[model samples]
Structures are given as C-alpha cells and as structure tokens.
Target: MYEEDAQLASQDWSLHPLGELPGVDSVTYGIVTPGPHQPAGVPLLQAGDIVGGVVDQSTPRMIDAAVHRRHQRTSLIAGDLVVVLVGRIGDAAVVGVEQHGWNAARSVGVVRFTEAGQQHGISMWLKWWLKMPEARSRYLESSAGSAHSTLTISTLTQLPVPLPPLGFRTRLLRTMRLVERRMVLNTRIAACAMKLADAHFVRCVEENKEAPRPAAVIADVGEVVGGMRRSAAIEDGLPVAWAAPAEVLRHRLAHLDRTDQTTWAPPHAVCAPGTILVAPRPGGVETVVSRIPLVPGRGMLALRVERETDRMWLLHELRSRSKELVSTAQGQQGREMSRKAFSRFTVAWPDSAQVREPFARIAVPLHERANTALEENRVLEALITTEFTEMAEQTKGKR
Candidate 1:
C-alpha cells in the first residue's frame, strides 16, 4: 500500500483495496481480441468514448452480437464506471442510463457496483476520486509499457480507496452531484444552441434554393495563407495568440488570452475575425475545418475572405459541405490538402447581399449564445478542479 493510502487508512475512515470493496461486485477488462469492426452491431465502447466524465455514445464502433456475447463478463450496463486502462490511463466515465447494452474495448476496464453500491453512491464517488491528480499519478506510476502504457488487473485490484463515513460521503456526493448536473445542463444548452444555428442556416439556404447559385472557387473568394514553421527555440518572438490544428479541429480558437509566448511564432499571421481556418491534415472526426478565426499558429491554414463576401454564409456553406471538403484532401500519409487545392475548391456563393443577411442576423446570435455557454462550462470546470484540489488537500491533512 502507498504511504498516502496508509495515512488515510490510519484515520477514522476505512481504506480498502478496490477489489475488496463490498459494494464493488466486479472489476474486469473487456474483450481481449475483438473481431473486425462492423458497420452495425453491438456498440463497442473504447477509451476515447469517455469524455468530460461521461460516455460519448456518438460515433461508437460496432461488433457482431456473437463477439459481444463472448465478452459477456465485460458487457456494460447503466451505473457501471468505465475506466481507461491504456494510453490515457485513469480517465473514467460512468455508463449513463441511455448507454445500456454496450460492450467495452480491450483498452477499457468496467467496474460494476452492486445495488448497495448504487445506494451508497460508490460510482459517483469513484468517478470524482479517480480524476484527482494524486490518484492519476499513482495509476501512472503503476502502469507498465513503453509506446503504449497499460494497467494490469493486479495493479487495479490493489488500488486503494478512501471510505469515509456514510453521512459525510452523502453530503459530498450531493454537493458534487449538483455541480455536475449544472455542468451537464450547460453542455446540453450549448449543443442545442449550435443545433439551432445549423438549422437556421439550412433554412436560409433552402429559402434561396430557387435563386441562381453564383459559384466561386475558394481561391477567388479569399487568400489562402499557410501557417509558418515555428522555430524549435522560441526565445525571440513577440507574445501573441497562437492557433494550432488541434484548436481548429475542436472548432475553437486556441490560446485565448494565453500568456505563453514560447508557442507563438512569426509570419505572425493574424487571422481577422471573419477569416476561415482549415485543417489541411486528416485526424479529427469533427469536420476537418472551422471558421473560428484566430491568429494562425503552426500547422494550419487560414482563408482571409474578401471584404465584400459574407463570411458567416461561407462558414455555414463549408460546414454543410464538409464531407466534400474532406474528400478533396490529397496525400497518402496524414492526408493533407494544399493551398492550391483549397484555392480551386468551388462553393455556392450567395448572389445578393440581401440573401445572405438573414443567415448572419439569425445564425450569429445563436452561435454567440453557444459560445457563451461553452465559456461558462469552462469556468465551471475550473471551479470543480479547485474544489477537487482543496478536497484532496483537506483529506491529506486529516492524517
């Protein structure tokens, strides 16, 4: 047992290895050798599916029912805590009510708590505890492997957990549950806002279906500028916002009001507010392009729209036709689109300013609202992090 675990165990609270917990019915890994993926079958949950302490059922891989049956021990149901046992070790998410009848990937571990566990809020407590920095560090220290680290069953079984008094646990659970509920509500609100914007954009486009489509090659509408190759040593550049391909992938501006100047490099391409950013490389699932204008940092491309063009309209149109845009990308490794190719890509251009005005008027506000909700979620996340840190400190001081 770790010294910290011993210290906590010596206190009034009981400390037990995870496997010995009476409420925990089972702690097991998923399918060892999954069969080839299928277009439609049983939903197979992987480590990546868990994001923001919840299972993201969107875009899950599937396997045959036979394979799922073969891995019955690892079959997931609601109330189970799924932990990433490989790569991003210690990341966990609870199998939600809607996520029943799912099976886990080899990279994930399923912790199924008993009815007593549910009554005691074991899953809820475990989810928050596993996310603590100290817990994560301990897990990392026990994990083995070079290129791809993994958590062994033995290591997982030996993991220690603090079992405080039931009353204290209940109060803590209630507080955290309220905060989590708010966060979940905020996320849903943000999603609905974005969906509303998309719907409005579609309606606007459909309304102008009868109008003549004045098409323009992307090159004609804007200047396709490539990002600079950042220097290895950044001892000489001015401090500025730097946007990377990852930020573009996430459809968000990178380093907002950030102070890190080391990543900021020159050619210092300042992408204006209306400019569209494109990820020439293929890796992310969320459209390979975005229009969240920011200073183009490293490994990204920016499209500076012509002054007369409708930037919002263009953004919506690109997003609507993202599949075609992704298909246009060339190259074998990493599959990237060049500036020349981007320049030649053609899109429907609104014939009149009047036709595009409605979209901008309605869509902009909806997007703004969504962005506001996202920012609120970020603030909430920061607060939760602080709370968790303080809680850990207090628990440590109890010794």
Candidate 2:
C-alpha cells in the first residue's frame, strides 16, 4: 500500500488480490438464514459477537445444531479470521481453537488462510492488517454508495495485500503478538473484576430481601433522562463519540473503547460521567456504562444519579435484571424505554446506611480497575499501529 513512496520505486513487492494469494482459500460471508434462536444450541457468531477486536463467545446467539449443520460451508474453523461485514466494517479477529465448531451469521465474513502467502505468516499478518486504520479506510472506500455501508464479498476478494519478506513479517508480528497478549490479559482481568462485582450485587440484593423493607421505585436513586435525536451536524462539536447505538451494542465490555471517539456536534444536554444508559439492542434494551462525558443520543436513555457512587448499584439494577427491567417497561414503552414506563419500574434497594454504601466501596474500585485496563489497552492499540506502520515503511530495505 506504501508503493507511492519514491524510495520504494525499485522495490519488487507484489500487491496481489487477497483471493489470488498462494495461501488463501475461498474468502466469503457466513450463513444467510440462521433460523430461530435456540436456548440450547450451537453458537452463531454475528458481527456483534466480534467485540473489542475478538470473538466473544459468550455474547453470540444460539441456533439449532441442525441449522448449524446446514450451514457447514461457512462453519468457523480454528485459525480462521472472522471479519465484521455489515456494521463496524473491517473489525477482524482470529478464531481461537476454542471456537472451532461455531457457525457465523451472514453479517460476518469467514476467511481462512493457513499461514500462506509470499511469506510464512501471511494469514496472521493479514488478520492484524484488517484491524489497522489504513485497511479500514480501504474497506470503507469499497463499500461507498450503498444505501447502508456494507463490505461486499467481491471487494474483499479483490483487496490488495503486500507480500513482505519473511524475516521482516515474522519479526513485526512477533513483537505485535507480545503486545496483543498483554491486551488480552488485561481484558480478562477486567472481565473478572466485573464478574466479581456482579456477584456481590446479587448477594446484597438477596440479603436485603430477608428483612421486610419499604418498597422503592427507580426514581428514588436516579432520573431517567430521555435521548436526544442526533444528526450529521453533530460532527462539528469539540468532543464526540461513536453513534449511541454503535457504542452501546457493538461490544460486550464493561468500558467503551476510547480509540473510537471522533469530534461530533455540540450537545444541548450532556449526560454526566457516571450516568447509566439503557439502549435498545437486537432483542430488547440493555444497560451500558459510559465513563467519559456523554450525551444521551437516539435509541438511548440515561439514568442520571445525584451521586457517582450510586452508579455501580444502578448499573447492575438495570443490567443484571435487564429482562425484568424491559418487561416492566413493555406495557407502556414497548421494547423502547420511556420515562412513563421507567417511572413504574420498581427495584429492591438496601438501606443506605448499611448495604448500599458498603457495596459501593467494593464495587467502585472494581469498576475503576476495569476502566484502567481498558484505557491501557487503548494506548497499546495505538502503539501497535505506530510500530507496525513504521516497520512496514522500512521493510523493503530490511529484506
């Protein structure tokens, strides 16, 4: 892709179409019809399942094994590179050995290249390449002019790829893997911290029910602020983030990725840092926490609280019992949340003097721990791009 440089004028690198590369097999999308969801069935990975640059197995939907068997042609094999095709285009993650038998939805592309190319590790390099900004730009360019942006299989097959010398490619990816491993370790730590906090929240709720206490409505702790309809004009603002729906539903992490931020339209009403938002996803509305300054944009409703300490409790109330939360709102707001519907929802609150404050002491630190890990991962993500791009520019001479 850097062939435009004057120094590379005499370089003999090949820029072959991805499908034409020696190591690539068929590069294609996943199952078109997944049938109905089955509670006990084979997991079907969707674009939504590729969160924070990995295939999060826990977040995928389940389809009958029969449906999965019918879509065997697109079955995910261990080491295959899964690429998001519909939304958040160009997100890619290698299928780990644990995900070998899963099937993917039509919105995800399944690419398998067992380390083949002009070099020994082209598949690994290409997997990381697809996650790079430069490659994302190409994917966006290819999807131009559609009613909705989407990466067609034809464009991906024809996408150009470099054939760097083995030594440079190996050394570059070797360093990259070390950095990536640390990111993943941090991700696991954050996940564990969240799980522990959730467990504590559950225990406290159970213990509170043992004693007869006055009932409480959601309004006791927080206010349900409605969403603002955002437009393209928002891009002119100083601090902006990904569209609300994309930020909330695209991933299953406790913290949102800061690298995805962009300048958007100025806000008439900005939600506080610890506001808890309930937004509509594929099935129903779910809770998401935003640590950064945020505006409650379309398809999102924020639970603005007086104290930041109350956030952890309120977040779990909406998140852990979200099905119950959505059910309460369904009679009034349907699947979407409304102030009227949210007003009627009730949650068991512990006495502030005892349970609530102590839980906060434990939960707040865990939330901070997760935020710290995700923030560091963002820095490492930037470091990866810088190191890889710099190495790529000097690769020709190295070879």
Candidate 3:
C-alpha cells in the first residue's frame, strides 16, 4: 500500500469493505462465459463500454433476452457503478439513465446503489477513487489467477473503502465533479471537431463523385512497405518512436514519451510527415487508416505517397473503402492485407489539379483543427491526473 493511503487509513474516517457500503443493494460479476453474440437483443456492456467515468452506449454487443435473464444478478440500473474485475482491473463508470437496461459481461462487476439522494454522490466518489493509481495498484496486488489476473467476487467484497464525514464527502464530491465536467466537456469538443472534419471530408468526396476518374492503382501513387520485425531478445537500440496497430487505430501519433524502444527500425522504415500508416489487420478492419503519421511497427504497413495527392483526402478515401479491402484480405487466422494486395488495389484518382486543390484546402484545415482539439484534450487529461495526485497528497498531509 502507498504511504499516503496508509496515512489516510489511520485517520478518523470510517473504513468499510466495499460490499458493506450503506446503499449497495447487490455486488456481483456479470454473465459467466456468455455464448456468441447476436444482432439484436439485450445490450451487453463490456469493459470497453466504460470510458471517462461514464458508460458509453455508442457501441454495445447484443445477447438474447434469455441470456440476459440468466445473468439477472448483474442487470444494470441507473446510478449503478460497474467496475472491471478482469484485464483492465479497476477502471469504473456509473451506469447512466440511458444505460439502465444494459447487462454487463463477465469481466465487469456491477454495484447497484439503492440509496436515493445520496447514491449519486457516493457512486461518483467511488468511481473517481477506484480510478486513482494507488487504488488500481492495490486491486492488481490482490488479484489472483496466473493466466489472467482476476478479482473474484469474494476478494472484491473485502476491498477497503474510506468513508469520510458527510460534509467532507460533499465538498470533495463537488470539487471532483467540477474537474470531471470540464474533462467531459473537452472530450465532447474533441469528438465534435473530429465529426465535423469527417463530415467535410465526406462532403468533398461526394461533390467530386461524378468527376472523370483517372486510372491508377495504389502502387502508382505511393510506395507501400512492410514494417520492421524485431527479435524478442533484441532490446538495445537508439530510442525511436515505434507504433503498433493499436496506436494507429486510435488516430494518434506515437512519440518517444509514449513508445518504448524494443528495437530501432532502419531509416527507410521511419515514416515521414504525410505518410499514411495503415493497419491492414486491425481487430476492427472497418477503422484501419490512421489520421496521423506514425512510425509503423511489426504487423503494420507504411505508405509514402510520391504522387501529387491530397493527403487528407487519400486518408478519408482509404478509410471509406477499408471494409472492401478487409474483405479481400486472405489470412485465415487473423486477416491481413499484404503489401502486394494493397499495392494492386485500384482507386478512382481525381487528376484535375483544380478539383483536388480546393478539396485539400478545405479538408486539411478541418482535420488540423480536429487534431488540435485532440491534443488539447490530452493535455487536459494529464492536468487532471496531476491534480488528482496533488489532491490525494494534500489529503494525506492534512491528516
């Protein structure tokens, strides 16, 4: 345990096992070993559903009502706090009114708070508390299972929770709420910026849909090359930005701060600005093209466009048609679109400079603005994290 947390533990604040919280109606894991998902039925919330201290219902898997009923113990309701007990461990989010009918997956532990007026404040505090770095470390330490770390219901039940005085709790909740609201607002702004950029890109493509198409293959416009495959034992190398498929999927660039040096790639392997880094075999092939340039690592491919093409337009076009390419990929275990396959793929290239230039002028700025918004959100997130750490330290000092 952290020294600060230990100090807090000795304070006058009451301590209770998580399961002993006053309003907790039920504490249980979700459906155990659920079967294959269906198209339409009860929405199943997984760990991925919990993002930024709220349940995102934007994308959810479906299971039949019978399956949902079988897991009635984990049936979610508004104000219920869902904690991830496996994989991600202690990440948590509150089930909002919109997510009331959802049922969680086995990896998600549901805590339903029955107390009316006070439930919201307590639940919010718990959500933030669990997200703290020290709390997450404690959860991992207590976790069992060698193959994959897991928090069993019994173990979770015994987890310690500090209960400060009602007045202190209210004040702390207010401060946390203010920070949370700003964070959420920043996220929403970033999302809106990206959406606007996407809309503009789609509009540009649609407007030029009827223009005379020039015959060209992907190879004609760019150099498609595979990424470096480093040996597992090789570690010593100059630090360089290395990006995997996951980073590309997030539409973010990899940097020295975020990427570790497993091994360095050759100079040719380094991606230049305006390079299109594509993950042909991402878990979700529908969203494969990265909006940002990045150093592609193994299992990824880099495309450096040599021809005069609008980079943003090319990116959007490839994304728009990614599903088609994914369908043509030939791997049986994990589908991968090889360099050969990508190179041969044909695209309707707009040859007119007049048509392409205007599109680039408008689309580029929108995407740049979107990227700026995303960068701002990242800074805000870091600031909030630092603020939380400082607040925790202050609390310990006061005690």
TM-score per model over all chains = 0.75, 0.83, 0.75
- Candidate 2 C-alpha error for residue 276, in Å: 0.9
- By lDDT, the best candidate is 2
| Alpha-carbon RMSD of each model | 5.7, 4.9, 5.7
lDDT of 1 by residue, 3-71 (tens): 433332233556678877647878999887878888878989987777667887667889999999988
> What lDDT, from 0 to 1, does candidate 1 have?
0.68
* Residue 340 shift from truth in candidate 2, angstroms: 2.1
Q: Give the poorly placed runs of model 3, Cα more than 4 Å off.
A: 1-26, 116-120, 139-168, 219-234, 238-284, 288-309, 397-399
Point out the worst 10-residue segment of candidate 2 by lDDT: 1-10
What is the lDDT for 29 in model 1? 91
Q: Give the TM-score of candidate 2.
A: 0.83
C-alpha lDDT (0 to 100) for residue 167 of candidate 1: 60
Name every residue pair that clashes in candidate 3.
Answer: none
The ten-residue window of minimal lDDT in model 1 covers 253-262
Better of 2 and 3 by TM-score: 2
Model 2 misplacement above 4 A: 1-14, 38-42, 59-72, 114-119, 144-147, 210-216, 234-239, 246-250, 258-263, 280-285, 328-334, 392-399
